[model samples]
Target: MRILLAYDGSPAAETALGLAISRYGDDELVALYVAEVDPTTYDASAFGGGTDDVPDSDEAEAVLEEARERAVQEGYELETAVEQGSPSDVIAEYADEHGFDQIVMGTHGRQSISEVIVGSTAEQVVRNSPVPVLTVR
Candidate 1:
């Protein structure tokens, strides 16, 4: 099966990667890192703050490299990609556009009011994804 693993270098994401590797080692796996671009017009730089929400190219590369290394350690060749957009949208769209059979990702598992107000990426992806999404916490 063709699987797309949404990787963000988080602990949960690492767990998801490990699970995918162990269960679907021989499947076609692609680790996708979505660099969430801030859609707001607010500029943090003007207020003496750095724009840390949006990751740079180097950071994206580093995350992909880490995923690749982990897959290699498991004796599997993994494909990787970096995309810029809302994480949930990019993940779901990429899976559909790339003809993936399923998507595997990690969830923060936050149940607080803030999480309810602003849903987590995994929740959004689960709601909007074209294929089945397996979320590992």
Candidate 2:
């Protein structure tokens, strides 16, 4: 069984990783971290309107490294990647393209208004993914 684990270094995502390890220890585990690019973060810099520096890839790498270490501690070796895109789209597409048997992810558990406005990445992935998705809160 090939399992794709969506990790972002959040507490919830870590919990999801743990669940994946515990449930599918022998399966091939792929840890994926989507470094969502909010255009607002770079728009100003791109236009040279502000002095704020464009963020580096270091942060994304750090998140993946942490996920890798955690999986190692759980006795599961994982393949990892840091992708740039919307979280839900990247996760769902990657799972589908790679032919993963399942996808494990975490939800922020936001409430009504906030959830409606910002939307839930896990929920979107669950709805769009071609494979089964297991979401941990």
**How much does each candidate deviate from the true structure in C-alpha RMSD?**
5.0, 4.9
Q: Candidate 1 residues 1-137, lDDT tens each?
A: 99999988888999999999998889999999877666586454554543343457588788889999999998998999887667888899999999999999989632345556889989999999999999998
lDDT of 2: 0.79
lDDT of each: 0.84, 0.79
Which parts of model 1 are misplaced by more than 4 Å?
Answer: 40-55, 109-116
lDDT of 2 by residue, 36-131 (tens): 656655453464532223243577678778888877887889898776556788899999888899999888632345446867888888889999
Segments in model 2 whose C-alpha atoms lie over 4 Å from true places: 38-56, 109-118
**Per-prediction TM-score to the true structure, in the order listed:** 0.83, 0.80
**Candidate 1 lDDT score at position 62:** 89
Candidate topping lDDT: 1
